[model samples]
Target: MKESSVASTNMAFTDCMTPTELPAEKNGMRMKNWRNRIGLFLKPNLSKHTKNRSHRPSSDDLNQWAQSFDKLLSHKYGKAFFLIFSKSEFCEENIEFWTACEDLKTITSHAKLASKANSMYEEFIRDEAPKEINLDFHTKNAITQSLHDLSASSFLAAQLKVYSLMENNSYPRFIHSDLYRGLCVTSTAEEP
Candidate 1:
């Protein structure tokens, strides 16, 4: 049997929407602002979640998704972005195909919208803080730990079971909490 690939039949659904053209300086500023906003909202919660070290979960999948999200937003909202939904209207028909596209579409769109909003806010509202302050090393390390913790919380054979569960909607939520929110919020905050 051949390994299954997550490819969407609907090309439109998989495309990402890019933002309007902007000078390099302004574009960098916009991303910084968005990163700040997200960072502020998630830092408090994600920080606590990262302290437990007994767990040692791998972040390969999460990292891949994050990279894909960044690539989409870099377009400046010109192309269509998507997130593959694990369970959706087409779940019964295309199962893997439809779901992957939906989740990717949703995630990419969100990241792009967030970037745009931050860009507009920085231009009109106020300048954001420096980019270096919002590091998520702590959070990422913690989540990696928690993934390992879950297995202890469950049986050995069921080890990879919870891992699969992590792939659903919660993955996005987790990413936002651990990565985007923290990075975005910190960069957007102004220096006192």
Candidate 2:
């Protein structure tokens, strides 16, 4: 596609998104504002800098994402897009911690396991850490205790809690967002 055409399509989608609503707003206006804000923020942002640039999701990928959260997480582009959308919502910690737990599980080194566990705990599970999740007291304490002699599965419960949080919360909002919806809508429009 020509740069001019791409710009116009970008404009069209941009036009459809309503302005972001304020936190004090209610009902229909909030969603309207969210769509508008996200449309602008995500505005044709096919980043040249991303590792997945070579394998950006096709319409098939978007459709697949709509089917299941697991499907979305499994797709590189879908995960990247979802991460971006989550960041916009200021809830990236949930997914970030979830990803950290995943990475932690792959470690064969006891040394690395303890090191990564402490880092993950400080980063997410600890109270008022930079990007905290709301794990229950028991779960948090158990993970904390395990930190002294951590195993790969030490963070499993906490990980599951965060996964359930995302699967039940952000995943639903994401599927219906203008960011996701517009991508699906515009991608189809561009199809032959």
Candidate 3:
């Protein structure tokens, strides 16, 4: 089978594995090991439960979706829309990397920043990383250099590059996707 298909299958299987089936070990070693191996590859799907469902876009969101990539990215519904669209394209790693970087910026502790920087680089920047994102040589080299200092801005260059890639490349396709159209129709039908 193709790589994408295998990934999809693994994701499906992993999703179906309930918490009960993967009980925590007395020493936490088993759980830690399991998380290290599987968590890097398969992110839990956020769209499965009703509570986790993407917010239906408002008219303002719809208008902004057509107007600016920045606006679309600012709204949760828009983020969710792009995430679903990126998954279809098998390039969800770009958005995931972008999102991780955004989260990384909130860290105030030097120790936390150091740990997270290493983890992010290993997962998204290293060659053959599980969730390796596409990055130009300059951005990649910048990230490499930033790792030595491990500041909050360590991933900024690569993050911006991935964000621009999604905005320029995936965002257009998402706007044209049937999923986006369906969301528009559903949101429109719900308006009073």
Candidate 4:
């Protein structure tokens, strides 16, 4: 697959429009800001030696990522690699927004839920959000309405939408990229 494959979200193909009707993008341009890029780059590499460490991900994790998108996101090493790879593709917002939704699910405090809900909206759902994902009018409106009285489920629809976008678009590209293949190679080289 090409490095520049299908777009994760082409806003024109919102809930109201049929997939067939969506226009073929000629330039293949997507909104990507450097703030997200720089933030992701600053994190320490998970594979590097540390004073205190947990399990260093095995080649098996890299192999498993090939099996499914869920497997890639579920494994820490795989997820870290995927995030970096996605960022290179200039669509880091999709994963960042999805990760935020997953984090939101773990919160029990109503105050925190409302706060997180609004923040996710501002960052990923609002019309001019810094990392806005392409969403239809009704879905965006529905989420906005729910924010007044929110819960973990307030962003469920949006989260699922982003998840689907990544799965259908980014995940495949990551699997095909040289970075993923190199990780698998390096992990196996350490064995035997």
Candidate 5:
């Protein structure tokens, strides 16, 4: 399609999303401050930005409306409803804010959980990667670095996915169990 046609189509689609008609299908998300709050959040935004930014408010109304919609959906549908977005969308819009009920400290704590997972992946690859090899040192390091990146990315993908390792009783659970057991054993042995 032509650029102008695409832009117009986008505008029309956006116009159809009315906050007043939100809270449909008992999705559990509510629009607590459907109008005012969204207005503030999308205050400085323009309509065009929304399509490009992904979950971003193109206008003030969209933000306030989404916040309200989310609240209603959570109340009715529960936590499972919020998993509609992919990880990129969740992170972009800061999904944890409302999911954890706006607790900044808890949000930070969850972030640490994700960060710790990433560090674990990196550390595993680093330790396993060969130090001395037939290739040049730099080349070996580069290959190891790629391996590290792949491991870390996989971990993140698993965590962010709603039905993935986040709740799986397999690899992640085993790793955590092993880690805690190791810590406990180390502390006991060091005691006088």
Candidate 6:
């Protein structure tokens, strides 16, 4: 056989053999094989950038809305209801303001509180804001004063007002609407 044919046959045979049997000094092939084996076990199975959706409320949570306003707002279905209800002109800002306040409260870093507070005021409180919420002058002034001190509760009063508005106004309309009624039917059907 030609020299090339003999080399090809040897290459094919070696490729079929296990890495452990290969020489440690052969281009550090043994280390490469061990590293790959270890890497698989060391690497995490989960994606770093994926958001956790486990916070979504169960069907039981939806059924308990009549028990308390707090229960309703905390549930994921409450967010869904608000999103649909906000489709009316001038109504979307209420939900937006409440959501911004919710997000603001999650920030634990002291340095971030001031900046987030300022942005929230600009977007939801200041006159002629792009998405100005229905804040009375008293609530707006309180928020403006709180911005100087900058805490998680800086938007509390305004948030509470909007939350009350939603609870008393949009929420009743939502409960009486077809969308909410459909969700109720679907949730009941899903229960075993």
The number of the candidate with the highest lDDT is 2
Q: How do these models rank on TM-score, best leading? A: 2, 4, 3, 6, 1, 5
Q: What are the per-residue Cα lDDT tens digits for candidate 2 across 1-192? A: 996676556434321112232143542554455566545333443444544423335678788899999999988768777876776565778888888888998999888888888889888888999987877899999998998877889999988888887887788878987678887765565444
Position 19, candidate 5: lDDT: 24
RMSD of each: 21.0, 12.3, 11.7, 7.7, 23.0, 23.7
Q: How well is each residue in 90-136 modelled by candidate 1, as lDDT tens digits?
A: 11112222222233334435455445334322332222422111113
TM per model? 0.20, 0.73, 0.69, 0.73, 0.18, 0.64
Candidate 3, 1-192: lDDT as tens digits: 996676557544332222223336532553344335434223333433345323356656877997898888778867766775565555778788888898899999999888988999999998899988877678888888888878888888788877777776777777876566665665565555
lDDT by residue for model 6 (88-138), tens: 312677787888899999999888878888888888789999888777788
Q: What are the per-model numbers of colliding residue pairs?
A: 51, 4, 0, 0, 17, 0
Model 4: per-residue Cα lDDT over 1-192, one tens digit each: 442233324423321222222344511221123224333333344554544323445667777889989998988767777777666565678888889989999999999888888888888898889987877788899999998888888888888988888887778777886566656665565544
Alpha carbon lDDT of residue 146, candidate 2?
A: 90
Off by over 4 Å in 6: 1-59, 88-90
Per-residue error for 51 in candidate 5, Å, reads 20
Model 2 lDDT at residue 190: 42
Q: For model 6, which pairs clash?
A: none
- Model 4 error, position 112 (Å): 0.9
Q: lDDT (0-100) at residue 106 of candidate 3? A: 97
Off by over 4 Å in 3: 1-54
